[model samples]
Target: MTEAAFIDIDWAGRPVRIEYQWIARDRAAAPLIVFLHEGLGSVAMWKDFPQRLCIATGCRGLVYSRPGYGRSTPRAAEEAWGLDFMHRQAQEVLPALLEALGIDATRDKPWLLGHSDGASIALLYAASYPQRIAGAIVLAPHILVEDLSVSSIEKVRAAYLETDLRQRLARHHDDPDSAFWGWNDIWLKPAFRHWSIEAEISAIRCPLLAVQGLDDEYGTLAQIHGIARRAAQTELFELADCGHSPHRDQPERLITAITAFIQQQPHGDKP
Candidate 1:
C-alpha cells in the first residue's frame, strides 16, 4: 500500500484535511471505484482490500479517511454528531472532497464501494445524485435503526470503555475518541432510534449490490432486504458464516461478487 496524500476542502464552512490515495492510478481510463470506509474505519483500516479489488477488476480506486477518523481533522471535544451526520457526509463532505480532487462525478460516474456506515453514506449519495454514480456495492449497511443494531453498539461502547478496543482503534485513528465517541454517542441517543433512510433511498436510480453477512452481529438481514425492496435496481448477496465486516471476513467472495456485478452492468466500461 502507498502512503496517503492530503488535500483540504471547505466543508461545513471549515477547512477539512482529507487523507486519501489512489490505487491503480495507471488505469486512468478505466472505471473508478471510490471507497468509503465504515463508521469506525479509516484509510489504514481498509488495509489492501481496495488495492486488491482494483487489481482484480482492472479499475482505478480512490480510498480516503473521513474527518475525525484517520490523519484527517478531529472532532471538537464537545462536538456530538447529529442524526443527520451521515446525510451531511454524503451531501456535503464527499462532494467537497471530489471537487477538491477535480473529480467531476457528473462525467466520471464512479462506482461506490462502501461498508457499514460508509455503505449507508454511499446509498445516500447515490440517491441524492443519481447521475454521479455508476453503481454501488454495499456490505452490512444500516438502512434503519434496529434493536439488534442498538444492542450491538451498546456492547461495543462497553468494549471501548473496558477492553482493548480503544487500543485497536488507536491504530487506525489519530484520536480514537473522535471516531469511537462520535459514532457511539449518535447511535445510542434515544432520538436516533427512529432514524431510517428507507424512504430517502427510494430516489436511487443507479444499479446497486447490497451484501450482508448472515451472522452479522451488528444488524440483521432486513437491512439489505429493505434496500432491494425500495430500489428496483438492487441485487442482494447474503454470505453465510460471516459477520458485520464482510470485506474483512469474506473479501474474496465479496470482491468476486462486486467485480461480476460491475462488469455485468450495461456500459460497465469493462477493461
Candidate 2:
C-alpha cells in the first residue's frame, strides 16, 4: 500500500486546504469511501482506521478535516458557529470538498462513514441530497439534543481544562482549544437546545446503518433507535463497554459492521 498524500484542496469559497489522504485501488473502477470525522476529530485522530477499512473493503478512501481540524486551517476566534453549524457542514463544506477533489456527487455517489457529530452531518447530507449518496454508516449520531448531551459536554469542558485531555488532544490538533471549544461551546449553548433533525431522517432514502455504545455517556440509545424508527431498512448495532467514540473504543466491531453493511447493500443508482 502506498502512503496517502497529505495534500491540500480548496473548499467552501475560502482558501480552505485539507489533508487529502487517498489511495486508488483501481483507477478504472473502485468505489469511493469518504470518512467524516467527529466534531473534535481530525485526519490524524482517525489514526489508521481509514487505511485499514480501505484495505479490508478493497475501495479507495478520502479522509480530511473540516476546516478547523488537523492540518486544515483553524477556526476564527470570533467566528461563533450558528445553530446550523452542522447543517453548513452538510450543505456547503462537504460538497465543496468533493468537487475540489473531482468526486462527482451526481454520477459517482460515495459511501459516507461518519462518527458522532460527523455521523449527524452524514445523515443531514444524505437526507438533503438523497440522490448523491450511495449509503451511510452513522455511529453514535444525535437526532435531537438531550440533557445528557449537555451534561456530558459540560464534563468535557472540565476535563479539558483540569486534566490530561488537553495534552491528549494536543497530539491531533495544532490548536486543541480551537477544536475543543468550538464544538463544546455550541453544543452547550442554551439557545442550541432546540437543535433537532429527526424531521429530516425520514427524507434519507439511502441504506443506513446506525451504531451506538451501550455505555455511551453523551446520549441514550434513543439516538440510534430514532433513526431506525424513521428508516425501516436501517440496522442498529450496540457494543457493550464502549463510550462515545466507537471507532476508537471498539474499532474491530465498528469495522466489521461497516464492512458487512457495505457488502450487503445492493449497488445501483441512488434512490
Candidate 3:
C-alpha cells in the first residue's frame, strides 16, 4: 500500500507544497523507482499502478505531482510557463524535491519511470546528471517536436474549450485551469515549435528503455527510435493496440517489460 504526504520547499524564492506518496519504503535496500506523471496527470491519476509495479519489482516507489497539479501549489493565473518549463522541472525542481526528502541520488541512483511529458523530463534529467540515475524507462517521450504532436495538442485545446474536458480534469486538479493552460499554452506556442532535446539526450550514459504506443496520436515511434540512435544503451519497445498512456491501457505488459528491463541492469540485484 501507498500513503500520500506533503512537503514544502522554496521554489523561485517562494514556498511551494508538493504532493507525493511512497510505496514499499520498508524495503530499505530495495532499488528506488520514481514515477513521473504526464502533462495532465496528477498523483491521484496514477491510481494503483505505481504500487503494483513496486511490489512486482521488489523496488521502492515514489510518485508525485508536479507543481500546479493535484494538491500541489497551483499555477497563478498570470504565470505563463516558458518554453523551457520541462527543462526547469528536470534541472531544478526534481533535484530540489529529492534533496528535501533526503534522497541522495548519488547514493541511491534511483530509476526514473516517466510517461509523456514526464518521460521527456526524465531524459533531460538523465542527460544532465547521468551518473545520478541507475536507469530510465520512458513511455511516449518526445525527443523533438512533431507535426502530429502539434495537431493533437490543437485538438485538445478545442476539446477543453468546447467539451467537458475541463470539468473532467477538475476532478484531479485543485485548479483545473492552472494545470490545463500551463501545459496547453506552452506546447501550442509558436516559439515552442523548435523545441528539441535530441542533441542533449546524447549525453545520457545510463541504461534506457524507451516505450511507445503504436497508436499514440500525440507522437510517433520516431520519439523512442531517436533515443536509441543517440543513447548507446537504449532499448525500444513499440506496443501494438495502445495509445499515449500505456500504463492505463496495457498495465500488465508494461509491468512485465519494466521488470525484465530492470532485472537486466547490473545494479538491479533484488533486496
Candidate 3 lDDT over residue span 8-39, tens digit each: 98888898999999998889899999999999
Residue pairs in candidate 2 whose N, alpha carbon or C atoms collide under 3 angstroms: none
Write the number of the candidate with greater TM-score, choosing between 1 and 2: 1
| Regions of candidate 1 where Cα sits further than 4 Å from its true position | none
Evaluate candidate 3 by giving its C-alpha RMSD to the native, one decimal.
Answer: 0.8
How high is the CA lDDT of each candidate model?
0.92, 0.84, 0.93
lDDT of model 1, residue 175: 97
> Using Cα atoms with residue i matched to residue i, what is each candidate's TM-score against the true structure?
0.98, 0.93, 0.98
Instruction: Give a tens-digit lDDT track for model 2, residues 1-271.
Output: 3443444555555576666577564543666888899988988888888888876776778888887777677888887888999999899889988887788989888889899999999999999999999889998898999999899889889999899998898898887877988899999889999999999999999989999999988888999999999988899999998999888899888888788888777752111
**Predicted structure 3, TM vs. truth:** 0.98
User: Is candidate 2 or 3 superior in lDDT?
Assistant: 3
Provide C-alpha RMSD values for all models, in order: 0.9, 2.6, 0.8
Extract clashing residue pairs from model 1: none
For model 2, the local distance difference test gives 0.84
Taking the candidates one at a time, how many backbone clashes does each contain?
0, 0, 0
